[model samples]
Target: MLLQMKKKVLFILISVSFYCGLSQSREVDSLKLSLTNSKIHDTIKIKNCLILAGKYGGFSLDSLKKYTLDAIDLSKKNNDYLLDGGYYFMGVYYSEIGEINKAKESYKKALPLVDSISNKKKFGQILSAYANLLSETNELDEKIAYYTRALKIMESIGDQSKIAFTQYNISNVYRLTGVDTLAIDYLQRALISAEASGQKSLKGHILNNLTIFALKNKDLEKANTYLIESENICKETKLNLLCFHTFLQKGRYLDELKKTLEAENAFLTALKNAKKRGAPQDIMLAYTYLGKHYEEAGHAKKAIQNFEKAQEQDPANAERIMSPFSYMSWSRAERELGNYKKSNEYLLKHVKIMDSLNSEKNKKSLAIAEAKYQTVKKDKEIANQQLELKDKASEIQKKKTQNNYMLGTIVFLTIASILLVFLFKQRQKRKNQELLTLKREFQIKTLESLIEGEEKERFRIAKELHDGVNGDLSAIKYKLSSLLEMNNKVIKEAITMIDDSCKQVRAISHNLVPPSLEKFDLVEAADAYCANLNELNPSIEITFQHLGDVVDMSKKAEVNSFRIIQELVTNSLKHADASNINVQISNRNNLIQMTIEDDGKGFDKTNIESSGIGLSNVQSRIDYLQATVDLISNEAGTSYTIEINKETLNGN
Candidate 1:
């Protein structure tokens, strides 16, 4: 496709040259001749060709300059939003020629037109071009502002491909401003977005830029990854441009890695590739890099040769290109070649250009400031007018002749008296309603407390019957069998039956209420339960620790706390298959802290919330006591921490 474009461009140049030779008048004839070029027929194509021609052609400049104005006028006549784009391109060309005022004027004209365009994708693209033009001179803030606007628009439109380009541009601005980490973030985002969009071409470009950003950030791993991705994309696309870029990037990465031989090879490949493509700009860059590589390797003479080759390829580029960045390579190369005077000269020029770029940027900033001042002034005026209009309306109402002061006073007093009586009645009604609500709440709490007390009493009685009476019954059966001598098989069987019945009854009662927990305090209860648990599961190990002096808690708090602990221990012993458990109790700053940790097969919290009945009961009981419980469980283990305010426990 590029070959086809080259053929077409050649044909147009030849035709225009032929026509100009035949015409008597050169200027008018050259203009007329240019009209026949396909680049002149389509405004979009013409704008693109003008910019491209500026980079390559000598004679194309005059024609491109003329057609740029023509394109702007045509766009306006056609009501095309692209007129803004044309104006931006013209600004770029003028900047290239160092015509600051003309460039500024063109950009000013483009500004509103670009804003008026409703298409977000095109808006983003045009804004990016405008930003790039600003960045050309050292208008750092303006470049950032415009690029930010473009990025936001691209992101809003979900134009993934264009957004990647914007990200790269933002990264460049950050890098120039000495924010390497921020630059890396943007460049990485650009690479990811570009790759996700399946835009291999854009991916390659972002990858190369990201590599540079990472290198600046001193992130060799990130730089190498991006370089590899860039190289792969370049190979896939057969993009010689990207190959040249990534090779240079890899050379820098290798240099940072201290692999000088690999770095040198990469640099040589980049230089060879750039030369093969006949891209003077890229070749010059490659030569500058080679100079740096040689200088680093202690080959000063070879470094100077490479620097000279770079300068020879693009000497005029120092002035002809608006990019403040262009001088960086030249300045470094001149310095290392021991041309201190020339190096300082280039460096001063570079700095001056950068400052001028900043000044131009400041002018735009001043313009924006002026615009904001006018906007605020206009808003104030509008507000003042509105205020005056309101005052006038009030005055007009006041001017009405009716003055019924006495009548109004009488009516107002009567209304006030009636409203006072009505409000009093309403307040009385609300007070009565609140009293009724309080009574209902009190009754509910009384009923709840009574039910809870009854349940506890029943549990205590059941435990006593199981542990005390059932144990006595089993002993009695054993004593009777001993009294009968139990030599006969029938008598022995009957004695075993009685013992089994007693054991079953005791188990049932223990299930109804744990006997040890009822008889002991929280700490003793927990220790005794863990001991019983360890006896039941000999493989399990349980450790208990107590801190602070034990305070006598109310019976309700004690029962609830004991029941919760018992339920937890039972679940751990039965289902957790826990080999090691640690229970800690402490009191600090008027709060009780109980933490239970276990190296168990932890259950998923979500699954437990959905399916675990025992956990639900524990959580409900804790919530009723106004205590806080936090459970952290993963594949490795389970941890439960319960915190109870000592005040809440004491109140019970």
Candidate 2:
């Protein structure tokens, strides 16, 4: 019965994989038919060629290269500005095939024409592709430079999808280098841009990678959350490859969590799915994982069987499928099964593969050294040629100088006489303007420094009150509790007074610096404050709504924004005597928009002086953030709106 259940589950997974593959194949066929049947223009044909190349990239290297080359030739023949795009695709294909030198050359050819390309979107795409190739070569610095350049171009063009794609690639590189924090940061940025651009496929990819990163970080809960989201997206998009990988990752996570039975079932399902799709590499990986599980469980015979199956499914280029580890696993299983000879044989094979890999690495190093030598030699030749040209030019310049000296001296004197007088006046004006500007700058800086110092002191005092004085008072309270056993009225009264004082001190400390503001973003901090308000005043309902994506901002902006919202909410709860308070924070056109509304008796706009220190603090924070504020108050209710530009907060 258990076997039957396992077979049924495997069958279902295989069926799903098959359906997704069929759907994708049908789409590709439809696109091909459209290209063949239509009388497409040259530009359209070139685009179709590029699309076909990308579609074939994973399965057929020959076809991919052929189409990419055709696109380049056709674009050149037509004098189309998308020639750079064609070269970009060609570079991608070469890089995919491990032709690093050729790929780099193709990328170099494309970059010069990127700015000249009529389509800025395509130019940005090309730059991103080039950067990806650079990443594969281990040229991380150059890769980042190209990615940054691509980001600027994409942003300038307002191509959100390309921007997301570029960010995703950057995150991948960071992840590869083990920079988990930066990787997550870029991935989050990519997610925002992808969702905003309605690029569900790209968003799904980012989510899937994020799941892997979270798993690496031992954040199982976050990993599972990201995995579920990615799975949903893959199912919706019918992305068979991503679905296969997601199942594998899920199985690995389950295995790590010690859910052995569930992990085994997942691995079996992944194996079936990969077999259904004819993905040899994934099939081998699934079998390898299953073998490892069995080996760990002391099922030597079962482990050996699975390892053999993995070996059978492994591709010709087994190194690409982690062949060394697979071989080691096989050797271990064989040794456990008492097959000494076979274990020794597999071990030898593993060593041989490693040695061969090392040899290949050495050869690659030698090739790189030779290439560098040739480059240096060429540079020297170019330098010598430039020196010759410079010497000849210098001789000609000397002759020209002699001939023009008498005439030039007179002309120079006349021009200098007029220029000196004009420059003197311009200098006087510039100096006066500079002095005024410097004075204003000094005043602004001084004010900013004072505000910063004040905040720092407030934080210091708050920490001392909480961690020092408050701790001592708590200890004293504990001691007083012991005295309570005596049942003395005087002791009880003293304890009550101490408790009240402690409460007041705690409140004062919190007022100095809200703990939430220090730890959370503006939106989260505000939500926390509102929750606290609801707890204190059950009659008043405070609702918080965050729309769109909220990215991380500068600390100053976050702190000031939290303070402004806190002050507004407090006023509404205490002075306004409001029954319902609504707060909305949203991102629009790269600006943060915050709105607070309360249903309560409002004051007149003309009575600004009537408002207390809370309103003044709000204005002060707004000025610090360089944000715009609008307030509307009436007999019925009051509403406050603030627009904050993030660039201004970042000191752009």
Candidate 3:
């Protein structure tokens, strides 16, 4: 069971990895198709369908707004419990481009959807995105709650990559709440999953988060390690935006280590790269870091100059223009300069911004509450509508029930007819098989009888030639020899002719049936055959190797073996055009094995069975002895192995 589970897991991993390896353009289309197919007129499909619609619509702000509204309309048209989830996506899209209120409003809309979502995976993604937005804006508790919900869903589905992302976001929530140890723990888990999955983008994202966590914990060594990893993965993947961000992190790590010169260089590099990319958030982040670095180096003028530059570049509604770190730096710088009024002014401005950010979050909470109330009210109305729908559904069901009985009767009759036909087919197949078996048996018997008769007739003729013809010629030779001593040239010529005729008759008989096998042994007969085969084809080489005991089998066995070998050697010479042929005979454990291997113009195994009769004849002989023959042929050569059971040996 454990092994089976491992196999299943490996299969799943391969499938997921294959999909993940597709290019971004392919993934978009695949995801779109998946989303389209997911629509089932049920709440789950409706939720996913709207999410997909919103995603496609989010190519630009104008398109995003248009698509998001369309999604909202669809969600309402479906009037699903998961309707709020679409609003969350809208909020995220709006917030991304600095529309905080719009973002909050959309997030509020998503809350009701989350409440009614039947699908865990869909709800989890929604919660995760919303949680991330909340964490970024400093709603720590709310962020943690949503992340937990998302993480649970991810765990359920075994989606390790998304689970890692959710954990990383959760860690950020912990970091926001000043829980550094827990944050580190979660981030480490996130890192493991990310690396295991080869999710380079997610890994870089997690590493960047880990860098911030390490910096917060004052673990400069740990911070640098993660920063280097993040930078390398980002650069290798050409994640330019991520690479741009990692520079600022590296600068912070250097500053933490008190390498002021190196830190300044890092900060400058980060600013230049971020400016080149024209990423406003990254540029603001770089300036924030550079300001702190300059302030720590005791360059108050440069510190103030960098801080003011960051504020100017920050978008008009940027809530966190003076980052928490920047505010700390600004406060210290003002106090050091003895400008009490300016110090208080900066402090007051920071407090005001923080207050406004908090107020925006509160407004979000109230909006969510209002949305929830509207959702509940809508749910009640839907419930009443469902009650009416149920009555209509009952009427439809009554009609369907009557239709079902008729359909079932037809189906039953159809199934019975199919069963009858199947049984008849089975009966016919059995009859056909029996007829085939009988025909094959009759064919085999007739062929065997013919072969036996032909072999017996050839043996008789060979005996006649060897005995009668050779004896008569020898007698004529002796008579001629006696007369040739008296200058009888005609007689001598006649004797010579008769002697040649006698020799020709002996050769003919030997060719008809191997003579050595009757007089000598298997090896001698094989040697003589090889010698004659080589004579016929001088270009072909034949090697014979015999091992272990050799037994002289019955005439029938010998004749069959000789015939098979003769055919094999003939075919090799005529068609194989082989350079070398090796015949190996081995007797081991009371079994006889013959192997014929040739370096020839080899044939393809696929084509061999259909191509000619040589293989068919070989197979037939092996089948007669209930032995096995395996022919392995390829482009390089051919190998044939025939194994006969020792127990079945005719003369054992």
Q: List per-prediction Cα lDDT, in the order shown.
A: 0.66, 0.72, 0.66
- Which pairs, if any, clash in model 2? none
By TM-score, is 1 or 2 better?
2
lDDT of 1: 0.66
Lowest-sum lDDT 10-residue window in model 3? 1-10
Mind giving the per-residue lDDT tens digits that candidate 3 earns over 1-652?
1111111111111112222333334444554465456454545444444444443321233444554465567667665444564575566455545565666676666665554346565566656665555533435446556777788888988877778767776666555444568877987898898877667766776677777767877887888888888888866865444555577778878877889998898888878766654545556767777878888899877887887788777547344544555776777777778877777877876787678757755765655466558779999999999998998999999999999999999999999999999999999999999999898678667656765786788789999988888888888788778887798888878987897697668756876778787787666777787876666566889888888887446665666666666667667766776899988777777677877888887776777666453566666566555567788877677788878776875334
Candidate 1 residue lDDT tens string, 249-327: 8998998988889999999998776765555656667777777787677676677688677778757763543244435
lDDT of 2 by residue, 1-652 (tens): 1111111121122112211332444466665675565576777667666666655543355666777787888888897546766676667656544465787788778778766447676566666766665532346556677888888988998878778888887776665554569988998999999889776666766777777777777989998998888778777866544565667778878877988888788778767766654545556677887887787767878888888787676446554444566677778889987899999987987898788667755654555466568779999999999998998999999999997997799999999999999999999999999999798667557646766787899899989998999899889888988988889899888889888778777866876787877887778878877876676678999999999876467777787777778778878877887899999999877789999999998877777676652477678677767789999898789999999887766343
Model 3 / residue 5 / CA error / Å? 41
TM-scores of the candidates in the order shown:
0.39, 0.45, 0.45
TM-score of 3: 0.45
* Model 3 global lDDT (CA atoms, 0 to 1): 0.66
State in Å the error of residue 178, model 3: 4.8
Model 3 residue 450 CA deviation in Å: 16
